[model samples]
Target: MSSAPLSPVALFWRCCLWLILLLALPAQAQFTLGQRATDQAATPHVQARLVVQAPDGIAAGQPLTLGLLLTHQPQWHTYWKNAGDSGLPTELDWDVPPGLEAGEIAWPVPQQIRVGDLLNYGYEGQILLPVPMTVGPDFTPDADGTVRIGLHARWLVCRVECIPEDVQLQVQLPVAQSHGAFAAAFADAQARAPAVSSALTGQFEVAPDGQHVTLQVQGLPAPAQGQELAFYPEAADTFRHAAVLGRDWQQRWDGAVWHATLPLSDMRGATPAALEVVLGLPVAGSSVAEQPPAAAWRIAAPVQGQWQAAQLAEISPALAAALAANQANQTNPTTTAPPASGGSNARSGSWLMALAGGLIGGLLLNLMPCVFPVLAIKLLGFARHGSDMRAQRLGGLAYTLGTVVSFAALGALLLALRAAGEQLGWGFQLQNPMVIVALAVLFTVLGLNLAGVFEFGQMLPSGIASLHLRHPVADAFLSGVLAVAVASPCTAPFMGASLGFAVALPAAQALAIFAALGLGMALPYLLLSWAPGLLRWLPRPGPWMATFRCAMAFPMLATVVWLTWVLGQQTGVDGVAALLALLLALSALIWALTLQGRTRWLLGAVLAALLGWLLPTLAPYLRELPPQEASAASSAPGTALWQPWSPEQQTQLLAEGRPVFVDYTAAWCVTCQFNKRTTLSDPAVLQAFTLRGVQLLRADWTRQDPRITAALEQLGRSGVPVYVLLAPGKAPVVLTELIRPDDVLQALAGI
Candidate 1:
């Protein structure tokens, strides 16, 4: 009947059209379902659907189970009832028939979801929230023998960033019969819901100072007696959700009763007459493949202490205005508590002070160990251009341009990310293991190049190589960029306060401060270029230049060593070994590329394969590596002079009337290491700390620690190498980033 046999292309097009039509049919059906009981709402991070438990239609005078199912994309989660430190719980507003009633959601045990410095209670993966719906005897079926249920549901989904989504969903179910597709899900939800405990009795007493709450419970189950139990409070702003739990001093089970002392939130809004809490215990044995379920018991304990209003810390007007403006601009702002600023001595002061501080800080940054290696390269560059005054001046300007532009760009990125709710600060790049590894590899190549292992220009095409030789300005500019990259990890004396204040400033002002910092760093080199008299002091370009260039390579190599050590601190010894292997392979590849003929090609291919293998091997380490616990030696445990730091621990120690000194440092920070090896390690300083009964705490920022970040913010600092001395009933003394033994001794004496 057809006119002719279709061509292959025509036949393919016909099949594609049919496939599109088939796919479009389901989409059309779904649009109709959007107005019915089986409606589903999908978003980038989550999918929501409504289901009924009864396979048959609703029966009069019987209660039926209804469920709102939420399936999250991997690593994304929706909040629970309390929402802990920073999230909003899911909500459902139902429009039911006059005779039908809906009960509260039977919530399942929530998982502790930690995001940066905040700890949230939430659900991940798939969860079914079951609600009991009573069908009254007076209820009647619609004209079509079906009941229509309408729901307006809203939820906030979050991974690292949060997005609020809502849907108006409706479903039509048969009056007498329903599909039992979701019966098992409803049953599972019921099983996971926390039961009201009858055996356990509890009472809570607030500390007189209003800093902590102690809960005492009698009659524990045998399985949960000594096992680690999680306590989730039903009310917000009662306890510090981010405080580290499970420590013996915090929570413990004695012979007859369990006792737990939890810190009170600094922003605790009110005192409740009774504290309702869910105490959850892990299942005796659970497979990881399945959802690790918990057995939870709800307790409503009577309060036993007087209530006091939380003391609000004073903040600078600029910071307050900035925070207010930022909050006002957000359509859906996070409810995470602001960083505690009670002890902060950070003063924004006038704009002039911030600019001056940034300038002086950048100038002093040249003297830091982090910048020393790059300065050596600059020294070599200066020597090479000594004879050509015009070229030298041009090179200086190019370098300055590069430095200022790089600083501005970095500052802008930092500000933008923070605005988007990233918990980041100065030198945040070095916190990433990938950045550290990249720096290590970069320094290795630079060292090899300087040592005459290979020439960069020689590796390029003839024209590009000639251009590279002619345009030394590009090299000078890149050198400036590299200097800023390395120098950023060190927060020079005045830099901490300036950078801390800059974060709260407007984008324009913040960027200006960053540019000022770069300009100050470049000033010395710019001066040397313009002042021919200063250039004359340097030895003329000669045979010594070759030796000096080679000597500079060692400093670069030293930088590589430091970078390697920093990576080790972040990802452990295996990461260090992997990095070293990759570096060796890369060096071999570079050397092979420089060779001639088939041998070069053959060796390069082999090394490239080696690199390809080594590259993927590092991915496992890159994913959130667990922070290593500071060892006894690290905390000076032998002499009992130093211990690891935590905000709760610091508060407890201070509450106990002990002076506390905190050393906020990181492995990547050169100045921190210098201080650790020098003044901080001095015997007299240690003796003074011990003699004065001062508790020493080391807040290691080797890994990206939100708690440490928050603590630093409290002290008005944005980087490591922050020293603070605290004594009861006295203001917290904010010590400088670089401290001397005398400074420590005097601070202790004053305390």
Candidate 2:
């Protein structure tokens, strides 16, 4: 300032000298590793902070603790040392003055988080990583009596996507002779750090084939009364965590203690000396039911199964002895594991029980509405045979063959569909709209035949009748077929359990069960044929037989009407119209067959052609319409109080602490209708439901619904009239197939 400013040439020379000196400075100096506190962006998802976290002054030879804290956005996580299926663990490069020693990081227990199909081990939210350092006499304190450390860190933060991050952090601390300000915080961090558990001392070793690691612990007690155990591995890429734990996916829990075999992965490069895992045990606590006390263990797993030699690396001798003593106190000598999947895992029904149940159920079908039409045919034929045991037995045998073959075929189709991954069950054939429509058409024709529209046995030429649809054998066979078709939807007493067991069994076993059911249905008729005395109960065939036969046609027509309505339910109004039109066209052709000569043949051909063309068009249109409102959904003043059932609604009612009574019904199930009219709709039953505050839910499988199918599976059932009573926080009580008034009342009283 005293002299004049320098000339341009002199200024340029001075600037060049200053630039040279700046360039000569060390890179560390440029990085400035002397700051007391610093914040750096580790990644887009994470922010890192390095703090001295030390006492105001440090003793020359005393140990000091610091923290490398990382705060991440929600859902973003940083990997643990061994990052399961993927990701890299965070690492730090420390540059400090001479004579300063740094210890290994004390890692906290990491959580197992699954991403898509892969499992990852990492920490979410904020974590303060504790780093211990010791000062030696050779370590020089700065002129300001400060201690400094230069830290370079690399980490990865991930959510659905990952981001790599690095930070050059410098932290400076003042030398102090006393303890640190955050001594309690440091101690807490140390406590949270993972250490080998002595709670249950057990050996961990690889399988003999080296394909898996087996962890067998005999001393670990059941977590508390209502608690379960959780397993977590500590090493990175060492095990197939996701594939090994939970699901029916190779995990098995034995009763004595937990024995799990974890399949090894080839991704882990080398075999480490030890394996680390964490076990979460249930302990009593005031909060919730109990607190889960999680402990980590470092196990010395050798190359092979010298299980007794490997010990828990972090346990004390006293704790190990306590675990051994606890295990010895139990009386159970062996362990038992639960069965695998729901398919074959369930206990199977005994063959004798299934056979007996099917027989009884089939016999009961005679009393049901659907079987009434067939019953009329059977009784008429019985009178026609009149005490001739030999003739009756032959007819009975033919009928039995037809019935058994149909049942066998149904069973075969069920097994085939199951193998093809279709989630169908008993009565699954009815779930298809085409099957429903076809059944309707067949019933319609059967009704017309009963009404005398066309006589197969009486009117057809004897040559044609003997080998085709008109022979006595054909008549008996058709009668049996009709019986089976009508009887299928009605799942009688004990039938649900037996059929459920049968469907889950092998194809041959399942078919045998179906055959038994057919035999049961035919038993009464077969007995009447074999023993002549039973026919004496009825009057001899006479003029009254014709009147009775005509009268029986009404029931067949009644069934046809019901089928028409069912068709409407399945395919709206147009489907019903199409079916009725087809019936009319077919009837005209059959009527033409009764007329004389060429005229009859020509008229019949025209009608047949019309039907052949019309049937194809109808078949194409047999699509399932949208589900309509169920009668149960509405609580109109004159109607009984009930609600439409769904899996969600059933679950919701149960969760609300309201007792629920579910009626798994279908329109095609005649027994279900009978029960609704006689028992469920009775005043006493209604009063019981009202008194018990029962939420009545009706699941109508009149049409296809996968939810209903799934629900049936849960109940171990395959057909309808399955009445389940659910009480608040209690196991469901399944009532008998036939819902009598007293059954409902008694079930409600128990609830």
Candidate 3:
């Protein structure tokens, strides 16, 4: 018997399920800031106090202890010494009496707080941080001077959401000859504070190689197994919290001095003058409630001076120790570093490096998927002209020059936009729908042409072919231009670093880097031109060339299909239809250009031009369509297996004691698609996840998303596809940029 149609209730449930799957960003809004805690007469969720040790009234020309006390409301919490990804660090800015200088705050060890998927390093309940102050012998107590102190404090209070708070505190102590009750509390807080003499303190010195920064510290303690440490940079742009760490512990008479290999925060900026590194010894049965006593050390190091290949080894421990000590000595009783006035010339070196980077990057571009089709054509052209060895080589040289010149033009454009106050990046062009659509149409047309839909050689009117490639030099220049355009999507490995650096360099330097990239792209071709014998190795003119050319069309077609999907994502389904119409118009125009009769061809040209101009103009009007849902491959229930992408859903899954796996992917990335088809969607892997009760989440990166970009940045990655797995009550384990099923399983082993 046939089954009856679904009832209204069933239909409604299906629609709701679909809606929940489609709206993932609301679930991804894990980072929030607002007033989350209530302040009441019963007890405040947060409280601040300024404590100082002095006579009953306070005294001039005598030593004094300065301190701050922070208390949080029940169940709510405030930030710790090193607030993780989102919250602001607890900071205190103090103004004190003349002739009385305060020392740096002696911070106690802080607990790590977890809110959803993110981990913040801070505190939950009441905690006190103290500082010591001294009065100069020149001051007199009979003057009846009042020691006025002001503190500017900033902290973050969080419940489910986080809010940054700033407060101003004022306290006046009269110069007297006796002591107060609060002095004892200050003394007690001081004992809990980590000693300045024990923690690893140092200045970060950038290695000449630019790949590493060396930290030099004085009085560093010896390193043992399981030493937990964190580096806090005074400058926000100096060092990211996430990066591969390399630690070298040097044992000295006083303690072990740690020379950490910190990746520079921005290769475009100078290394920080000094970084406060707090290291803790793991204690038995210690939890967040019981933080291990932290060892405090300070190292003062200079960020300037050009150290070449010769200077790396000559760096002295004494110099590092002195720099650390100097930075520590100059600190105010406040823990915050003074605001930096301006950026230094560390960017100059970056530009020079960018130029070199571009050259290397360009050289690697020849092998990139985007440019491979163009390379085949160029290679075939060389083989056709092999008899004229010199000419063959000349042709290759011309192509190489073309690539370089075009890259220069692109670089200049990027630099110009930046100068105009635009926040553009390396792949910014790809973010524009118009650009993507245009490229899609162009690639589709090129694919059809290669497949023998029309012949460009026969279609051009008088002066057309000449305009396209009249002179060998012009042909070379045009080839270079086309080469760079084709190579846009396939970012060569080293080129990623080079391009990232170029984005932050000055205009001139950035352009130079691009020029270098062009040079790299054309280097091999130029070499073939300079020595024409290379073409002799290639097959002579034959039908195989035609076959190879036809085969190359497949890659171009694939590129077009990928771009079409990308266009769909950016402007939606209507935009995809518009792109298809544009492609059809392009094909008609190409045919018209090749037509024997002038009248017929003229009409095709006009129609083609009109379509090109009109379709894009109409694209913006198209409403975005929801993603097409495919039927499940297995009978597993959605609730028991795959959970649709949503930030709230993720939080819910974490709360349910389920391990969550997130895949941030894009349609444009061939690598991403391959992983989805071959690994992620594999039945074995799916079964493993199902058996383990894993909650799978997918974040589509086919479109430009600011939130995803920021998330990627937090992970120390600028691009995707990224796979992250978060187990209950632990830090998330990030898989490598490349995917491996075994690696994934290994990372999920214990969980």
Query: Each prediction's Cα RMSD?
Result: 15.0, 30.6, 22.0
For each candidate, the alpha-carbon lDDT, in order, equals 0.73, 0.63, 0.56
Task: Give lDDT for model 1.
Answer: 0.73
Say which prediction, candidate 1 or candidate 2, comes out ahead on lDDT: 1
What ranges in model 2 sit over 4 Å off?
1-349, 457-462, 468-475, 541-544, 597-621, 628-640
- What TM-score, computed on C-alpha atoms, does each candidate reach? 0.65, 0.51, 0.46
Model 3, backbone clash pairs (residues 3+ apart or across chains), number: 39
lDDT of predicted model 2: 0.63
TM-score: which candidate is best?
1
lDDT of 2 by residue, 407-467 (tens): 7777788779878876777777776555565556556555555566655533334454344
Cα lDDT of model 1 by residue, 85-123, tens digit: 888899989989878989998888888887887788889
- Of models 1 and 2, which has the larger TM-score? 1
Model 1 regions lying over 4 Å from their true place:
1-107, 110-190, 195-269, 273-349, 622-624, 631-640
What does candidate 1 score on TM?
Answer: 0.65
**In model 2, which residue pairs have backbone atoms overlapping below 3 Å?**
57-175, 57-176, 58-175, 58-176, 82-236
